[model samples]
Target: MNTASWGSAGRFGLARYVMAAALARTADGGAVVAIVLLVTTQGGSGSLAGFLAACITAPHLLGPFVARRIDLADDGRKVIAFACVLYSFALAAAVLSYGHTPAILTGLLLSISGCCGPLLTGGISSRLPTIVGSDQHSQRRAQGWDVATYGIGGTIGPSVVAAVSSWASPGLAAFCLAVAAFCAAWLVMRLPYSAPEHGGDVQNVPSAWSTIALMVKDGPLRRTLYMTMLVAFSMAALPITAVHMTTLIGSPAASAAAMTAAYGIGNLTGSIGVMLRPLRGSPDHLMSVLALCVIAGLFAVMVSPTLLIAIATFWLAGIVNAFFFAATLAARTEYAPAKGRGQVFLWVAAMKITAGSAGTAAAGAMTGWDVRIPLIVGIGLIGCAVALSFVERSMERF
Candidate 1:
C-alpha cells in the first residue's frame, strides 16, 4: 500500500478555503461581540440584546433548507461567494443601529443578513473534501486546517470588537468586521472550485427527511451531534460571562478583553498544535480528550478567585476548543456516509449556531443571577457528554 503526501494533495485549494473560512469566522466572532456590547453598553434592554443575538443566530436554523442549494449546486464556490457578498451588506446594515438606529430595524436587518451565515460556515465546511482532496487523510487534514482558521478568527474577532468599540465605537467595530465578509467572498471566488465528484447517482439521492432520519437513527452520527449540542450550550454563555469577567477584574473599559484574549491566544496555540500534530486517534478518544479539556478549563475558572487565574483557565478552554473542532471533523470523516454528507455538515454547523443562541438566551434571561451560573452549567453539560462517550474497534465500533 502506498501513502499519499500532504504536498501531493495540493495547497492552493486548501489555502483558499482557509482564507475564506477565517474571514467568515472572524466576522462572526466580531459580530457576536459587537452586537452584545453595542446593545447593553448603550443602555439598550437585556431583552433587546438577546433579541438581536437571536436574530443573528436563529436564521441558521434554516441551514438545511438554505444549504440544500450548496449541496445541489454545480459549483458551491459561486454559491458561497454570492452569499458572502449579500451577508456583508446585510451585516453592515445591522451595524447601523450603533448610530442610535431603532432596535426593531436593526434586528430586522440582522435577521436578513444572518440567514447567509450557514452558507459561509457549513456550506463552506462541506466543500472541504472537494477543495483539498477526497482521500481520508487529505479530508481529515483539511478538517483540521478548517478548524485552525476558525480558531484564529474566533480568537481575534472578540478583542478587535472589544478594543475598537471601547476606543472608537461599536458601529465602527462592526463595520470594520463586516469587511471580513467581502474578503471571504473574494477568496472564495479564487477557490480551486471543483465540480461534484464523478459517478454518484443524483437520482438516487435520499429525501431530506429520510437522510435526516437516517442520521437520527445512526449511533455515531447521533452521538456526534449530541456532543456538539452540549458543547454549543456551554459556548453560548461565554459572551455574557466574559463581560462579567471584565467587571470582576475592575476594568469596565476593557471588559472581557483579557479573558477573551486569553481564549483567543489559547485557540491560536491549539491550531498550531493541529498543524504540527493533527489528532492521531479514533474519534471517541479525541472526543473524550476534548471533553476533558472543557471540563478542566471550566473547573479551573469556577475555582479561580483572581483575574489572572481566570485568564489561564480561559486559555486552557480555548486550547481544548480548537481540538474539539478538529476531533469533531475527524468524527465526521469517520462516520458520515458519502451520501448526504453535505446535509450532515450543514446540520452539524447549524446545531452549534442554534445551541449557542439558546445558551445565550438562557444566560440573558438570568440577568440578575450570579455570573458563575452559566459557567457552572457549561461544565455540567460537558461532563454529561463525556459520560455518553463510545469508543471504536468493534469494541467501540459499528
Candidate 2:
C-alpha cells in the first residue's frame, strides 16, 4: 500500500497524478481569461466580464468545505473526480450561456465551477502525504514535482487561451478548458486508491470546525499558514505594480506580460532545482533562509531602474518563492494531524486566496498614487513574515 517507492509503478502513478493535477489547474487558471476574452469579443461590456470573473472566483473561499467533504467521503477519489466533472460541466455551461442566456445565468454556472475549484488545488495537495507515505524524503521529492505543476498550469493556461482564441474562436478556447477539466476528471479516477488510512478511524474524524481548531493549536502549522498568507499578499500585488511600472518607464504593455511569464518560468526552474536537490535538514529552517532571499529579490526589484531589470528581479523572486512554497508544504505535511490534513491544506489555501484578494485591492487603489507604494507594502509583508519566523524559532526554545 505504500506507494512511496520510486519503482516503475510508483513513478507511473505519480506521473498520472501530476498530469491530472496540471490539467485541472490549467482549466481553473484559464477559465478567468477565457471568460473575459469570450465576453469582450462577443460585445459584452468589461464590467459584465468582471462580474462573471468575480462570480467564478468568489466561491473559491468555499474550498475548505469541499475538502471537508472529500475527507469524509467513503471514497475520496470519487468525490474528487465528481468535483472535477462538475467543474467541467459548469465551465461548459457558462461558455454556452454567455450572450445566449441571461448574464446572471452564466454567472451562476461559473459560480458552481468556482465552488469546485479547491479540489483542483489544495485538495490535490492534501493527498500528497498519503500518496508518498510518511517518508520525509519521498514527500519532499513529490512536493517538488507537485510545485512544478502550478508553474506549468499558471504559465500555459493563459497562453493556451490566448493562442486558441486567436486562431479559432473564444468559444472554442473556453470549451477547450472544459475539455481539459473533463480529461483531468478521468485521470483522477486512474490514480491509485488510498494506501489504507493510517492515522485513525475514518468514521471518527473530527468535524471541520474541530479540525480548524487543531490546526490553530499547532504552533508550527499555524506559523506556516500565517507566513504563507503574508507571502501571498506580496505576490498578489506584483502584477498591478508591474503594469504601473510600464507606464512610468514608458515600456510597452507587453513588458508586464513578459514579467508575468518570467515569474512562471522562474517558478518552474525553482521546482526542478528542488527535485534535483531536495532540501535537507528542517523545512522550517529553509523557510527562513528562503524568506530572506525573497526579501532581497524584492529589494532589487524595487530599485530597478529599467522595466527589463524589474522583470528579471521578479523572476528571481519567483524562484525563491517557489522554494519557500515547498518548505511550507513540507511543514504542513510534518505538522498537521493526519486526520485533519485535508482541512489544514484547504483552509490555508483559502486564507491565501483571501489575503491575495485584499492585496490586489490595496495595490489597485495605491497604483494611482505611486507604483512604489505597493512594492514597499510587499516588502513590508515579507519582513513581517520573516519576523514571525523568528518569533516561532524563539518559541521553540521554550
Candidate 3:
C-alpha cells in the first residue's frame, strides 16, 4: 500500500506477478484441450481423451488441502514456485509417456500436475492481497488486472494449442504448455516475497473444514460462494449449448466460434472496465445486480431468432459475468479471515470447477434432446442464484 515500497522494483514485481500468473493460467486452461488432442492423435478414442482430461482435473478436489499448506508456508511464493516447477515437469513427463509408456502412467503424471493446479488459480489470487498491501484502491486495481488473466487465458490458451498443434505435433503442442508453466515458475521466483498475514506459523492456521464452515455460516460469503457455483453451472454449459444452438438454427457450426469469441471479447472489456472504474456499492449487492443482468442476457440469447442475435447476447452475458466474477473476488477479500483466506479462495474455486464439470456433462447429455433445453437449464440455474441473493438479503433484515 505504501508508495515508498512501490518503487521501480515493486512496479516490476507486480509486472512479474502478472506475467507469471497469466502464463500459469494459460497452461492450466489449455492442459485439458491439449490432452484431448494429444490422446486422440495418438490413436486413442474420444473416451480416452475424456478420461485423461478428467484425470488431470480430478485432483483439483484437493484444493482446500493445498491451500492450507500455502497458508501455513513462511513464504507462500516459494510454495507456488515449487508447484509451478512440479506442474511443468509433470506435464512434460506426461507428453513423453503418452505413446511410449503405459496409458495409466501418463494419467498418473497428469494427475500429479493437476494436484498443483490450484496454486495457479486460487493460490495465486490469495497472494494478491499481500502483494498489493491493505490499500483498498491498490487492491481494487490489482484485482482488476488479476481477474483479467483468467479472461486472457481463456481466450488465448486454446488458440495457442490450436496453432501449435497445426504447426507441429499434438505432443509438441502439449509440451508447449509445460514450457509456459516453466516460464511462469521462473517469473514467480522473481516476485517480491510476501507471506500471508497471521499465516506464517503452523499453529496459527486453522483446519480447512473450519474455512468451509465459515463459508457456510457467514451470510455474505455463503451467498457469494453459492452464487458462484450457480453461475458456473450455467456458464460451463455455454460451449456445448452454443454448438447445439447452431445446429438447431440452421447456422454453420463455425458460428459457435463467433459466439464464443464475442463472449471472450466481452469478458476482456469488463475486466478493463473494472480497472478504469471499479464497481461502486457493496460487492454483495453488485454481485446480485450483475448476476441478474447475466440472466437477462442469457434469456435474450435463448430467445434469439438468428445467430447474430445469439452471438451478441452471449457477448453481453459475458460482460456481466466478468463483473460478477470481480464481485465474488471482492466479497471473498472482504469477508475471509487472513488465517484462512487461501483455503477460502481455493475451496470456492474447487466448488466452482466441480459444479462446472457437472454442468458440462449435463449439457452434453441433454443437448441431443433439444438445444433450448440446455439454455433453459442455464437460465434456471441463474434464476436459483438470483433467488439465493434475495434470500440472503432478506435474512439480513432479521
Q: Name the Cα RMSD for model 1.
A: 3.8
lDDT tens string, model 3, 62-121? 878878877787777888888888999999999889889888999999999999998888
Per-residue lDDT over 123-166 for candidate 1, one digit per residue giving the tens place of the 0 to 100 score: 77777766665565666666778887777676678778988988
**Model 1, residue 221: C-alpha shift (Å):** 1.0
lDDT against the true structure, per candidate, is 0.76, 0.82, 0.84
Q: Pick the candidate with the highest TM-score.
A: 3
C-alpha lDDT of residue 182 in model 1:
86
Number of backbone collisions per candidate: 2, 0, 0
Instruction: Sort every candidate by lDDT, greatest first.
Output: 3, 2, 1
Worst 10 residues of 1 by lDDT: 1-10
TM-score ranking of the models: 3, 2, 1
Model 2, 1-398: lDDT tens digits are 35345467667778888999899889988888999999899888989989998998889888887787766765577877888899999999888888889999999999999998888888878766666645667779889998898888877888899999999988898889899989988998888777334334676666777877776777777777778888888878878888888877789988998887778888998899889887887877777778888788778877888887888988997898889889988887788776667778888878877788788999899888998888888888888878877887898899
In model 2, where is the ten-residue run with the lowest total lDDT?
195-204
Model 3, residue 260: distance off in Å is: 1.2
Better of 1 and 3 by TM-score: 3
Measured on C-alpha atoms, candidate 3 has an lDDT of: 0.84
Q: Which prediction has the highest lDDT against the true structure?
A: 3
